[model samples]
Target: MAGIFVYAETKEGEFRKATGEILSRCRGVADATGEPLVAVVVGPAPEDAPRRLAPFGADLVLHVEGPGLEVYTSQGYAWAVTSCLAGRQPAALFFGNTPLARDLAPRVAERMDAALHADCTGLAWEDGRFVFTRPLYGGKLLARAVSRPGHPVLATFRPNSLGVAEVAATSPAYERVQVEVPAGSVASVVKETIRQVAGRVSLQEAEIIVSGGRGVGGPEGFRVIEELADVLGAAVGASRAAVDAGWISYDHQVGQTGKAVSPNLYIACGISGAIQHLAGMSSARCIVAINKDPDAYIFKVADYGIVGDLFQVVPALTAELREMLVRA
Candidate 1:
């Protein structure tokens, strides 16, 4: 039987949701394959991470502690994981397609001469091998790939793709693991990792996202959109045009050049749905578009559409939602 390995990530001394998603997905693979779910955590072990993973489903947790790992370095992190994995020789290496995963996964695959599949939207075992499906051609096509013959098949999953539900279970075992950090790897010393200084939630992790575009007129127009977002308990996002115009920060930009987001509800206000913008948010469960132009590209894929002025429509919608909540 082949063993399953998961690379769980941590942020600000806590396990990120994407980490739990990968771990839970690996647990399913392990049960089906009759193997153990071996999860590896790089950097310091947050006190709550091990216990949090157990209920979600993990057989064994491997905590790899290293000083060099305090901040994310692509080569250093990859080296540490590759070293610890020598003993177990896992059949597959799973990662949540985060920024670090995007940088390090391919490097690890190249080092091991293993097959690599990135941004997988779904996964399943077939014919004694894993089949991963990822979007291609600007989310217009779905590509299914199989791993080549190798000791460890590397796969990175997209955020919000896997729906991992936690259930009550007996706590699993935890093991302390140590690895030697390679000194002569890539020679870029990252002095400090500056988290974007803002009060906004990250686009990839938000449950609801309210996005604006050029059709909103100017930076001042986004104020109304922000009110709607606040009423809905959502984060504000913007098209490339809005960011280019300095109407919003780059972190709030939703497009191919920015961040890919798959929220539960994505409301587009005045966005024309450029291919680049759709590429980032097409995975959203529900889409609502509001624009005066009926021919706007955003309407093509929107589940709900309203042809009207966003300034007027947004305030009315916000008021209604607030009233509904208060009455309830």
Candidate 2:
């Protein structure tokens, strides 16, 4: 059977949240096409990758590892993925829209002569074809795309789009493929990896986000936003204005040029809601805007709006939440 394959990505030996999300959704895609759900793990994958994937609708787990593939080198990973696809010839291959996938997926598509779609936010099976929906013009418009018949399809989906949900667990078999990467295949090697420490959840995986903007006044002003975020156990976010103002780091930025987020609850404090910023978080399940400006654009998309001094309102909101959450 031509199966539906997923590139199961990992961080620190555990599955990334977006990986689980793609698998959970693709489980339906596999069932619709009457094909096995296959997961491909590559490059420093966990030894228990197969065991971990079996309960997530995976019927088969393919582990690919070898010299030059132990760490992520685009050339090395691409070679493994393209080779696995050649042998399996799956109907479609899905990947989370991680930096690694953005680099590797295109290479695989090119190698396999497959149709490629990137940054898809939605997926569905209809009329005997798989449909992928992606944003265009910096998230102002949307477009649906499909692949030509008789061609393998490769797609990358944005994180936090299709959230993880339970799927019928299946006992899955495992296999390993060791390909000695040829010389010159890997152009560069990573000598050391330096990781940043973040006390809160990763923005892409966070269910709730508390964001601040220029109205925050300064970097120290973010303390209130952080307090609110702490009360809700949410991640902290910032608009491009705050980032450009040097009030926060770019890693916390949310905008057209920054990270797109789709948290369950997005709280925007002191943000004027520039279109670019809205483009990043408009898909949040619920938006709460707190701005002193009554006509701020953030109110347009907010599920709840509070027109007042964010400096005063945010602290009060934080205190109230802290008390309520503690009691509950």
Candidate 3:
């Protein structure tokens, strides 16, 4: 079938926000191109995967199930994606420009000898053609890429590039395809998956994030930011400077070289806005910058700026918000 294909990435048997984010946009494109919107999940799929995904404009959900597919092995998962595309011509295969997609999309593209557009900030059908826009020169410029309409196109979409919203509802049908993976098929095997910061909301999926930077002074300084995050139910982020200083783990770092995040709100405390850092979070809907330096670069991009010591401002802000939440 010549249709739109989406990789449904789920965590703990539930769909990740990125899955819905990409599907919601592709749903519109599917309507415009008159192509069926298909979703593919590789792993132990949730029982309600189809029902939950149908509203996002999925006409069909392909649940690829089999042994050696329970954990994410590059070769195994890549094979699963290829199996879905076999015997069918997909107008385009969409993957979130995430770590997994970054690793997996290219493999599929190479196997099929397809044109792969990586790190697309925008993917849309324009002037009756598929236009993929990506950042160039360290995000200094955006280049739009267009390809011939008929051939299979592969693209990786950035998270939060386009806001997520659902389309008209439908009862999506499902097909379970089994592909057996023999041992030694993949170069590496994952024996166990460990969870770090398991209870905390993930930085990428968070709607609000409270981040600290070099100005936090030390690891202990992150406590105030954590207090703010805990009260707001926001994830804690760190600048590369702070991460290098050992004030926080690299997992919390948000920058071009780190994780790209698009949250509803981003609170940068004691961070001097560098372009590298901005590339990751500039897409946030509402940015609040707190710094003692009045001329800090972060203020330029923040929706709200506070020229004050974060040590003082963050605690007071956290206290006030805590009170408000308690009152409510």
RMSD of each: 1.9, 1.6, 1.6
Query: What TM-score would every model get versus the actual structure?
Result: 0.93, 0.95, 0.95
Candidate 3 local accuracy as lDDT?
A: 0.87
Q: Write the per-residue lDDT of candidate 2 for residues 167-250, one digit (tens) a residue.
A: 987777888988778889888889987665357778877899999999999999999999998889899999999999999988
lDDT (Cα, tens digit) per residue for candidate 1, span 153-226 = 99988777776746444376788777668668757799877888367666776789999998788889989888
The 10-residue segment with the lowest total lDDT in model 3: 157-166
Q: Residue 328, candidate 3: how far off, in angstroms?
A: 3.8
Q: List residue ranges in candidate 1 displaced over 4 A.
A: 148-151, 166-170
Superposed Cα deviation of residue 48, candidate 1 (Å) = 2.8
Model 2: ten consecutive residues of lowest lDDT: 193-202
Q: Locate the minimum summed-lDDT window of 10 residues in model 1.
A: 163-172
- CA lDDT, every model vs. true structure: 0.82, 0.86, 0.87
Sequence-dependent TM-score of model 1: 0.93
Clashes in each model (backbone N, CA, C under 3 Å)?
A: 0, 0, 0
As for candidate 2, its clashing pairs are none
